[model samples]
Target: MRTLETIIIGAGPCGIRTAIILKEAGVDVVVIEGAAPGGKINIAPRVDNYPGYKMISGPDLAAEFFSWLNDAGVEMIGDLVTSLTKEDDLFIVQCEHNTYKAKSVLIASGTKEKKLALPKEDKFFTRGISYCALCDGHFHKGQDVLVIGGGNTALKEAIFMADIAAHIYLIHRRNEFRGSNKYVKELNDLPNTTILTPYIPVELIGGDRLTGVKIQNVETKEERVLDVQGVFPLVGQIPNSTYVKIPGVLDQWGTIPVENKTKKTQVPGLFAGGDILPRDIRQIYLAEVDGKMAAKAILAYLEK
Candidate 1:
């Protein structure tokens, strides 16, 4: 078991930002990441909202952040944390490869992509269904693909796929898109993309591989089948807090309730930030702010 002053349980913006602050303050800390460092941001095709950068690809921005982390000399461990437990005055973080003991712990695990609960959706996962267009779009070059959802993610995925895929079917349950005007307009301008509004996915059609999808009109009971080789469901995200079973800490939505200013959780010495923290605006800039706030609060708590 390794002992540390603090353990940050993610390598996303929040965790990386927190590590930078703590390291600059001369505090000992280590970051643990289950996958590659970027988290969900890696899948985003383009990010236009984050301040300081006008229009940058998600992977590029993530690379810049990782460069900063390296310059700050923050140590990162590549392992999945299985459980976190409070033991006396210390916190025990159990990972797949190692165990860590720390005076304080920060849970910034972020959110995981939500899946469309259509029949056989799980069976076709990564076989023909995907959540990341940037990651899987190349596989379907010049092929037909269907995108689900009406939010920014869905629109962005469609826009990204329009370049690689021969034709894209953008499906949404609502008549209007909930994404930004710029993205919606960009998607509409694409010649290879077709928008299907007021429709819901009924079933996936294929065996061992995805070949088509069954959809229905929300207003009317009319159903139709789309001949597409791939499907990308960009609906929404859920908090990655299944391993965090601390009673009275998580809300009904499985998000951590923390002070807006301090980012301190109800549990002593346990903090949360980023998407895992309950907040209406879930953005990378806000996640960075949460990281700074949590770092300051953790430093203050360590002094006492």
Candidate 2:
């Protein structure tokens, strides 16, 4: 087995970010990606909320991250981690190809996006439908858009789109919002964003690409037509920790639990960050921050 100081699972923003930091610190780090290196970030059409660029494509940003990893002298291995176990003082990471050993491990595999069961929703993903507003909002500048759900994430996406889109149609099945009052107020303040309550989406409209949505008022039994260029589904996030077993760590609504302040997990040598770990905010910048924090924690643990 190949030995290493740290092993990063998942090639998403968090894993990639952690690898860069460790490599720059002269720490031995190797990245193992289950799928392509881009992971979920590539599904986005465009991203504008990240610090540096006013607007940049999601794939382009991911590419830049990859470039940064290579420049930092980090090595990447394309393999899915099937199992993880502790052997003596080291951790055994098992993949289909081979087994690797590391002193510490960082879990950064973000969750997969939950989609509307509608047929066209999948076919038009990234083309007309999106899951991340910060990543896809710029592509819809000055265009009418529809936001699904009435939770915190939904309202957050609505507020983000209100700034870039000409108009927004906020649809929710219930007459209430599960999101905090502050966010609800912010989204409600947008003149261009119209909130539709007690409305259920029957199906996504359009054939080749998403053009609009079909919704029905669940309480009133009324239907309405809202024309839109894109539909953003911000229902919620499901974590990527189901397969791995580590005691003392809990998952809330399918998200891994961690110490909020330090992003440290219950396990001594294992840490988690980004969307997979429990966090209030799941933005790109915050995800990167979580990754940095986790890296620091790992460094500290290793030093001890």
On lDDT, the leading prediction is 1
* Candidate 2 Cα misplacement greater than 4 A, ranges: 116-147, 150-170, 174-195, 202-214, 221-234
The best candidate by TM-score is: 1
Predicted candidate 1 versus true structure: per-residue lDDT over 1-304, tens digit per residue: 7899999999889999999999999989999999888678888899985778888999998888889999999999999999888888989898888889999999999998888888899999888898899998999999999999988888988998999999999999999877888888888898888899899899899978999999999999799999999999988789988878567888999999998899888889999999898776678988899999999999999889
The per-prediction tally of clashing pairs is: 0, 1
* Model 1: CA > 4 A from native: none
lDDT of 2 at 220: 79
Estimate TM-scores for all models.
0.97, 0.71
Q: Give the TM-score of candidate 2.
A: 0.71
> What is the Cα-based lDDT of residue 291 in candidate 1?
94
